[model samples]
Target: MRVTQHLWFEKDMQAALHCYISLIPGSSLDWQTAVMADNPSGPAGSVQMAGFTLGDQRYMAIEAGPLDSFNHSFSIIVECDSQAEIDRLWTALGEGGSYEQCGWLRDRWGLSWQITPKRLGELMSHPDPAVAKRVTEAMLKMAKLDIAALEKAAKL
Candidate 1:
């Protein structure tokens, strides 16, 4: 059995997918094609579908005109091994997008993403409740997550 995360975009599906695959280390566009048969979503050739992979995950997306808007209900999370990686992706994905508190942001395409350091999870899972609480507080105050600052908070 196979399950893929399917996305519906009103526009810019290919551009968004290409940009997204470039950001991830082991990602690619598996296939893309335009529909020729008439369907409710479009007059026929207007619909476009593509399958892709981000790391080991499979995803399919369609450009079938506006059926609905992307919202907070769905988000993609990228956990980085270093602050530099987090910073890089944060800048790339957050460009021309809306920034939200605690490592959350919406890209120009209106897709939400979480760019966070892997260390954040380790610190949050610390045995001491104070450590976790401190980390949480620090994260809440920032639009982008900082590993150094979070570690310092956990130490306090």
Candidate 2:
């Protein structure tokens, strides 16, 4: 079975889709369609829906009006293999957006994202509880994750 994430946007669906597609590698916009009938968001011919893929994950976004909006309750996590990758995504995604502690950030579109390093899991799951705790504490103190600092906290 295939699962696709559906996102609701009040407007600027195309711009948001383009931004996501541009940030992710091996991503593309599949299609977009306008509403054929009058809808709550707008008149006929307004953007109704758009399909896009980020990496291998499929997502559909609808311009369903202000009836719904994004909140911190849900977020997409991007796992990075290296510090460079994490930095790139963090800098790009945090543009015109606010940064929160523990590598969390809100994009310009108000979508929440976590730019995390793969090593974070490894450090946080160390066999020694002390090491794991240290790493966790270190992570909690930072807005953007620092891989080197995390590794140091893990004493690795």
Candidate 3:
């Protein structure tokens, strides 16, 4: 048995999947198809469905009439290897969207994402509690995560 993250979009499943796959390496659109039967969600061809892999994470998405939009409770967190990676994803996802503290942002499609650096996790999990606390404090102050600042906060 396997589990996959699922998403629901009003009418932008294809566009959102393409945009998301473009930002992440090793991601791909596994398959997509429209509903051919007269389903409750919509008539034939009105609902679109897709299955994809975003860096080994399987996701299933459907573009049907809106039931519930994406909220911060469910977010995609990209643990970036470098500041450049974080910045690139931040820009791509933050455009025409809203920014939140501690590396959280809502993309144009109303999907929340966390563009965070891998270093942040290392710092957050530091053996020394003070170091981890400092890193967390610094991270809480920023909209976009900065690897340098976080490292400095770790004092390592």
On TM-score, the leading prediction is 1
Candidate 2: tens digits of C-alpha lDDT, residues 44-88: 887579889998889998986787579888888998888998999
lDDT, candidate 1, at 150: 98
- lDDT per residue (tens digit) for residues 1-156 in model 3: 999999999877788899999999999999999999988898998999999999879999999987998898999999999888998999999988899999999999999999988888888999999999999999999999999989888885
Worst 10 residues of 1 by lDDT: 37-46
Model 1 stretches astray by more than 4 angstroms: none
Model 2 accuracy (lDDT, Cα):
0.90
Question: What's the CA RMSD for each of the models?
Answer: 0.8, 1.3, 1.1
Off by over 4 Å in 2: none
Number of the predicted model whose lDDT against the real structure is largest:
1
- How many pairs of residues collide in each model? 0, 0, 0
The collision pairs in model 3 are: none
**CA lDDT of each prediction against the hidden true structure:** 0.92, 0.90, 0.92
TM-score between model 2 and native: 0.94
lDDT of 3 at 87: 87
